[model samples]
Target chain A: MRKLVFGVSAFAGLLLACTAHAQEITVGFVTSLSGPASSIGINYEKGMNAAYAYKDEVSGVKIKLIKLDDGSDPSQATKNARKLVEQDKVDVMIGTSSAPGTNAMMTIANELKVPFFAVSPVNVPIPADGHPWGVSMVQTPQLMVKVIADRMQRDGVKSVGFIGFSDSWGDLVYNGAKAAEANGGPKVLTNERYARTDTSVTAQALKVVAAKPEGFLNGGSATQAALPLLELRKLGFKGPFFGTPSLLNRDFVRIGGKAADGTQVSAGPVVVTSQLPNDHFAKKIGTAFHESFKKVNGGEADDGFSGYAFDGWVVFLEAAKVALTKAKPGTQEFRQALMDAIYANKNVAGTHAIYNFTPKSYFGVDERSLVVVKLADGKWVYQP
Target chain B: MNAQIAAILAIDGIASGAIYVLIAIGFVLIFAVTRIIFVPFGDITAFTALTLASLENKQMPGTVGMVAVLAVMATLMEVFSLWRKGALGKIPAALFFYLALPLIPAAIAWATAGTLLPTPLRLLLTVAVILPIAPLLNRIVYQPIADATVLLLLIVSVALHFAMSGLGLLFFGPEGVRTQSLVDFTTFIAGTPVSGQAMLILGSAIFFSFLLYLFFNFTLYGKALHATAINRTGARLMGIRPQQACTIAFLLGSVLAAVSGILIAPVNTIFYDSGFLIGLKSFVGAIIGGMVSFPVTAIGSMFVGILEGFAAFLSSPFKDVIVFSILIPVLLWRSYTLVHAEEEDEE
Candidate 1:
């Protein structure tokens, strides 16, 4: 029932109700906010809210955000996507925070011919079969190899060992880490794998610890991969433990504690926006984010998941505004114009960073999007 | 390898072996009683050690305070049990509640205190918490399941485990935790580094196993409980309260689980999901020990640990594969032997 004009991303057409007069445009914001992953999804919502705050009102006019909660369920995400496209009649839709859930809607968007933008997990498999309507904002697993390897090589790490989970997700990151490490310094000493629910990892960790490697890499979700870190420390492997974005999960810190301290790797840093490279917009944006996030979450901003989702709404609204100009007010022509505007996007500063979407390539990563960040004192601080 | 290297490897193997023995004892206790393999038993180590670590909260400072927490837990169990129907329902309900949010209070407590209490006290405190509740579980869950097939009982035990695990993720969040307490004292004696915590765990396992053996064989109460375990009907015919004996066995089994958790928590960081793994491997240790004898079970668990340790040292990559490969074959061979032994005894 809530109407956010580029405010919250709801399903389908809650926003489509706006252009009835051809006066304003609406976008649906879909993200998980009540499930196990809700807290993380809330971060994405914040980004959308801040972006919607509208300094100059660049996205055609005042935006209304139609918010939909997917609850981190893939089926629910599909239902929400359908709702946005049909009932809410949103001009365009933006944001759902996970890969499986994102992929579910990507298929729906492709079938329905709607644009879908998201943040792909850093170590997830590359969708070689790209969807026409799909554009994830972060670096894909294929490109992450160069970024991680370049950083590890710069840090002079050689002779790495890998502990991977025995699954496709693990394999994707394993291949990425291997490819990344191939061009560089360290020879891989060992690679061990386990089934998803396998709890006994001491033996596997022992293999890496005894190898006397410079550092170790684990490839799995936080729950499965975390056990070995403590076991390795027990067996006297004092070297750094590293992974891709999976390491950035709060569960890792919660699970591993002091064991997680010396660990370092790459992911979207949970940095205050101002601490970024630029002093002007970055500082103001970061400060606003820190204050707003603390108030909303009773703490600081997490990895800006909700914030980025919010930015996705910003993109959808911008395109909707321009779409309204090209198309007859309430027809499907509005959807096409919105899609064209999104595809034509080159540069727009988002809470996560300057957004870039091209007709050719939709993702924003190109060496700068992801950088090395260490888990120090239970919070992220830049390494590179 | 040189003698010094051989010695260090032996010592490392021995220490790890000790941890396996404690798991074995819990396995022996449960298997000896109802022949039902209880998976939630392993979580005793996960949550108990976590509780121990949380006890030195800024608010609480001594054995008295720790005891008070135990009392609170008992009262909560009673209330939750009452909600479930009566005292009998408390078993599953209490465990379910424990699984869902076992670590939140502990996490909050740990975050506030900044450190855990002394190691020995932490271990003892966990035993104290579990000891008072074991009899209650037997009176409710295990005693009723006594007449059922071992397989059916196992299914129920596993169901209880699943419920607990689901709750753990639902409440405590799907995260693991490390025991911040000083678990191991590492020393490089003559150039070979060894984990002192591993030694303590092994020694404790052996010591406890021997004490358990003496109690079961020499004490009247223990014999009555054993009689009840051997045959509930026969124990009742002999004028022993089968109900009280069942309570005793459950208490004894729970105490064993609590002790094992305390010992193993130092070996691996305790997490909610750890219970099943702990229970399975420990039960395996008991099975390898013949499922009837405490001494052998303790010895069996240690041996399993050493073999696992040796496998890790040898094949670093597929270490688990190697260990389990040996274990499965040995277990199959042993079952065949046990079957043959039974036939020969019949003859």
Candidate 2:
């Protein structure tokens, strides 16, 4: 009877150990699922999901994703972050597609000490003092602007006009351009701003036309970015138009149509993965994610939005692997471990960019990762 | 700003204001005859633009499906009412009026869509398809609630606006579309170059308003409409059908909305919800006219447009604030200048 009891107790102990090791690693996602910004959110979500499906399990632990919609409101996004940390007890957090929402989420991530990955381009500067427990999936605005400015300088364009949203995005792009201008790039002659949902930018377009710059830089994204270009074309401006990396999408080209032709935007390496040099760190991973995205998304070509999510997972997995070695999943120690792992990791390449997050630089990209492409015949032609 | 800049801004303002005037007129007509504020004015405008885009692409529009469904419901309601009243002789007429009338254009649109038809014919058919939606919407939504107070009707109109805008999102997706320009010539005016389409919008808005003035002044049908607008019960006692007058007003309002939409589509990108802001600006102008005088509404809306243009040049971010702030002073001036009188209580 004593021998039988010993065997049963040992078996029960083994079962408990297995269960502890098998506990799932949870990732919380908060983004705009139903609002004006839903297009960006939906595209990001699809890309993240495709990457998630491609490899769901990591380190023998099932990855559990708990997604929430913030309706694109900044307040709602903060609430979402609180819920993800306090209620869901997520090991890591990702998303809130727009800049404002992402900024809010970063604060919460810092307070809660959970590693956060932003799945879309954010305009607000991340806290540079330490690991704000956050890393951006997008190329930094400075890198994007530098690409455009460098091209303009090389092409001998002297003067440029600016039109953008009256938000932080506009400030960031303008600041980036100004930074580049200090380095002998195109001189910005005029500046104009409009709301994201505005139907007309005629006044701004007229002002841009009056300036008659050699080129124009529209600092909005998607259809919102397309409006100023459309108006400028209608007003017969006929100048080379430059845009941010955010404007590199199918909808931008499709909605803007003929007016969009000859327009240039800075793009991530994933946009033209095939055209990337073999030695480029982002090339192989970009091509792999591109193929996976196309297979899952009804043959849709991979863009930077999807590339962000795919690359975000790579960052997450890399950090998680290191975090798991130090502490078990579902613990505060594990969250802290994940953040430290991300902060310490250097030159870990995925798609979009060769991410090299450090204590001070969390955006993890520079001019090396960005390329300038012009929209011609509705296709992105690489300018090398 | 230079003379050239001022001229350009003025033309842009005038073109945009022309579209706003159409929306204001629609609000006045529908409110005058039917006591409904017509909140979906912008949604219908967006639908008209999207329908033309679909026709241009040679695809049967999502609008035809909406027409089919609404027509059936309207027909069934008309038939049921006639049968319950034992007015069997009137059933066929109701079917012909409600169902057959809308279907003819639907058939033409479906047949000619994606075909090699002349652009003018396709555009005409696009207008035809959009024209009947307002009246049918009136027949189904407004006629049932015709006896409701203006406030209640306004609420229903708001609800309809939300529904139509949502439907627009489903039909057109997130991308904004700009239709082909109706005219391509660029004319130099006052040393400032202006596109032919901009000229077309300003010219047609004025010409149509003149035509509307003539229609109201000279025709017997116009007299009946004016009578209905002046007093619904009094016109009914004089052997005029208020329902017929309501349909006519709605038809005219809808056509104006569609024409303005087509005109503005080339100037700016038209999204699913773009109409709401335009419609609201026009509402402000309509209020400036006390929703009574067409000429006053046109002038008010044009002023609103010009102010918006100047404000945009000065501070594009504050343009909306400036345009909307004008309404406060206009309302205050009118309230103080005009005599306060209580509206007659309806039975």
Candidate 3:
């Protein structure tokens, strides 16, 4: 009887010690840190780190962030997702810089029943039961295109040419522009495609220019998209150039230099936080994120990509706070509770926009979540 | 398409194709002398373009550091070789010409990095900075294994290509950079807008080709190079040093790469890895020339550019396929018509 009592007490004491340290929650981040999409992925990492550092602990639970590089490849992203879920046993997941990689991650998230928040714009068709498995921090292509269409209507653009990467992102942007045309928008004249690693687009540019569009819409992202714009200029083209949310970084401006001076970009509200009204919903947190991000990244302002990542972190934290009350971290119960809290949350203000996720829809924002900004004097000026 | 659009695209083709011609010229010269395919030729062009970009941005070019490291390494190897040959007295002159000459321009360029110098001087300085890389590379990489087989030399060339490309990534990052146009004027040619840069490309290609012809036909040094290319053993028996000929060819190749880079900088965005594709296209052009004739390579590359431009117009995505497919028929024609050399037939 004495030996049995001693063994029981020892077992109970060990369990108490393990529970104390195991109260920490782990979040996995997979993004393109070493390929063509690395610029956006690097900014995503910077923004997420700043947010996590700002909020070190959440509801008395320690948070651990595990970051992995996917090299802008879908296969690598899927592998990262599996490792995070099966081996690290992360309670929640967030990541990816490209749509294809994010789509690949969505499949894994659904299979593993882990809540994944994609920072890039992705349109994954979720079944009724798969709603809680995926949520996107990105504003949809339709939202960005709507903003572009509104601006084009204001600018009285009659015809427009489109050139983009030959991928899903390009298709989505083209479809969104076509949808906008149903509302009496500009006539889409030409659609051209180029690879991300292509060095020249003169042939495509010449064709687009020959079509005689009053304006051009570049459907690609970052510095690579700047190629078509430069080529257009070289071909003696004179027109306004509009870009998608993917061109919301300083690299595009820096690489394009004088040629990018008058280009307009449709982006999230946080891209022009300095110009946002004080009464705006996202103004306060957006400004704070900008200040914190600048302090961390050598005085460079937070871009649309950085804002999306920070917003994802904000949603993750809000859900985590609620889930902590239900179960301890590192348990299946905690994972289930976290996913439920995310879907149940309402009116959560992030740096980019208001998040109101529901069981029926995973994307939280709409057309109101975006704004059109023009590059002026090397800065993003809000076009209200 | 109308004649106007066709004329405009033909000008574009000639301008872009001039870059490939320059690259092919380098490959032909190096292969003729060294039996190496010279795969890193485009990498040198990218490096020069990025170096000019760094200069324009008022930042010291990363190439200065690279040159410094290479200079030190080449000097050490030369000194060691001299010591092994008991000719230590010659080390001072070798170090001065081989090491110090390269560093002088690098030092000057570094000193004048951010200053507003004349455009001519700045472009000249860019040329000077990249000129010594070839001879230095020859001394360090190829000279030690000069007697290696053709396959071994080709393997080394490819390895150098990868190394240089990776080094480009390390130095220039993945961002694509475009330098300011050397001349910023456009004029009409047959109702087609032809930029001054396009004119410069054509002018420079002609000038360089004419200059090479004169050098080979008129200069004793150039005739010596031709002799070396004809038969390395015979040239050595005739007391014309093979190493000296190889060094001159490498220098000429490097200069051509630098000039081509400067010419094309305004036309295309140069990323670190952009060279591989450009180099491969040039290689295909060189192969079409039987890897020997300069005029044949130049014409072949111009055809490539024209085919690419027209295909891109008809169907943009299939342009690469169209351009690469030309090589198959050319190779087949060569196989059917040409007699096999005895050494190659033995293999």
Candidate 4:
């Protein structure tokens, strides 16, 4: 009888142990794994994988990641978001490489009340009733483009020609420039636009040249961004060329070749992490991310898009840690607690920026997140 | 715009128009003979540009592998069809054309992929690598349904385009590539600085058009293709094989696309999906010609290019809208003038 009583006590103890250590948090990640946006989407996946490898758990709770591809379509992104929330029952959601897809996912996130972290600098509309569930990890186009506009003003440029994609991204950059002009930047001479897949921009380039602006501002991204620069240079427009952070990629330089030299652009500090000062806040975290990324991806991270994704993971982990103290994982209470924790986050150091979130503001970075860089000899050099 | 700006725009328009001309001719050739719209013609051009870029980078092109796989599939399909038809005697000839012909270039490309070759040799290799893709695609995708109506064939062609685009992303990542110019010099033409590359594009367009004209008017095989296009049953009754004519048409079409790709590679960034727009623009040109007259298609393509240039300058964001809108008027005119024939009547 004494032996039977001892066995019962041991079984109860084993059950208690299993209950104490079995918490798992599921994170649903959506990205464009195929289509035109796949180039940037693949980088986001790589960085997210690196971040997962760097920290597989938060506060002693194992993390689970479920990834989906949106094929760069906004409708597909919306469906993925819905599936992640309803079917996968994820605690938090992270996504998306393009603005349109992110915006589409944001609606679903809001409807479902799941906390979402967007890798793209997507604009979230001000809610009339409550705090938004979606937050952006990357700096807004206005904030990044302001740095360039300020530099243009400092350089005494009076007029500038603008060219960009005829999409939301282009509208954002152009509006950013216009806002900067209201605050003592160069006047934009012309607003020319092109599709991402256009084979030639000669007509647009010639028009920009005909305007004879003192400076040129290109708002396009990837290899296509190089088109205007090449055509402008060939047309003898020997003026200062400026760009937004979207032009920050190895493909842009490699395809642009010598024509990309002397081009100035604004970027996040993590883009030039190796050149950052030793005492900088982002340097240590950026170094960690780069190391982990190389280990995961088998090569160095060559673009800034990956750094944004890594920062998203860093921010998510910070919130998850606090949320774990409030409620158990995989519950409605826990998701609400995580959203509250993310909004309450303060001074969360990431590879790209030091994030500070609040109920009123979802884009948590400031001027400290941005830096000016110049393209020279097929590499980006930090510019003070 | 002043005269100098107008001149520059004209030069740019002509160079771009020359590229569309080659692609438009290819569209007309395949549609006339096979009744397939050949929506993936632009994908072939993109593959050629990508192949050339890979060669210049001293990397083994994905085309070699793609072509080899396609060749094997075509050969298997051909052999099976022939066997079912009790034409076992034709197996060797089928093997020679469907399997061996394509593998020869694939083998050469695989052998020299890692070593840098002369620019001319690299161009030749690039062309050779993509030569079998369209023909083999015909065998695999359309040969079995060769008697389908034009609308059905077009639906299949559209589906094939999407598949090719997906495959393109798999083979050549999403990044775009721009190759070095064939002739790296600029000369002033009537006070407008025209690059030698632009001249080469124009020269090649004229030369190929002339050569195609000569082929159609002089060569017996070319005449056979022409006869097949005009009346397939009539040509077959005269001992001409419509299938053989279809294969020959695809061959010639692929050559035009390959040459156009090489010429445009230096001028524009070529991505895995860039071909869709290029092909569509050329399709507009083809539609203007009623997909029948090569010379008229060439003229229509140049007009489209010039209009695109002016439209871009006037309102950049609406350039594509303007270019594509031309199709509506052209379609309306074609419908007003031409008699609609039923599919059964045509067959």
- My TM-score estimates for the predictions, one after another, are 0.79, 0.86, 0.87, 0.93
Q: Which should have the higher DockQ, number 2 or number 3? A: 2
Residue B300 of model 3, lDDT score: 85
For model 1 the local lDDT of residue A121 reads 46
How far off is model 2, as Cα RMSD? 4.2
lDDT of 4 by residue, B60-168 (tens): 8888888988999999999999999999999999999999999998899999978999998899989998999999999999988999989999999999999999889
By the TM-score metric, which is better: model 1 or model 4?
Answer: 4
Tell how far residue A341 is off in model 1, in angstroms: 2.2
Q: What is the full ranking by lDDT, best candidate first?
A: 4, 2, 3, 1
Error of 2 at A83 (Å): 8.2
lDDT of 3 by residue, B25-103 (tens): 8899888887778888988888888888888888888778878777888888999999999997999998896789989
Q: Considering only chain B, report the TM-score of model 4.
A: 0.97
Report fnat in order of the candidates: 0.31, 0.58, 0.47, 0.84
Which candidate achieves the best lDDT against the true structure?
4
TM-score of chain A of each: 0.81, 0.87, 0.86, 0.90
lDDT tens per residue, model 3, A270-355 = 87888988988889888778877876776565567777788988888899989999998998898889889998898888877788
TM-score for the A chain of candidate 2: 0.87
Which digits, one per residue and each the tens of the lDDT, describe model 1 over residues B59-81?
Answer: 33122233334445554655665
Better structure of 1 and 4 per lDDT: 4
Cα lDDT tens digits for candidate 1, A1-384: 356644566543565655533554556777887666665777677666655553324344554568888988989989999988888666566767767788787777777876677654422333445536656766676555556666667778886777777677667767777777666646677777765444356656666765778988777666446667766776668888777766666767776777778676666533535445654333454566566666655656666465555456555655655665677533577666766777776665455555667645657645555657777888777674
Off by over 4 Å in 4: A1-13, A22-38, A52-90, A98-105, A123-129, A295-298, A320-331, B332-347
What's the lDDT for residue B100 in model 4?
Answer: 98
- Lowest lDDT 10-residue stretch of candidate 3 chain A: A123-132
Q: Considering every candidate listed, which one attains the maximal TM-score?
A: 4
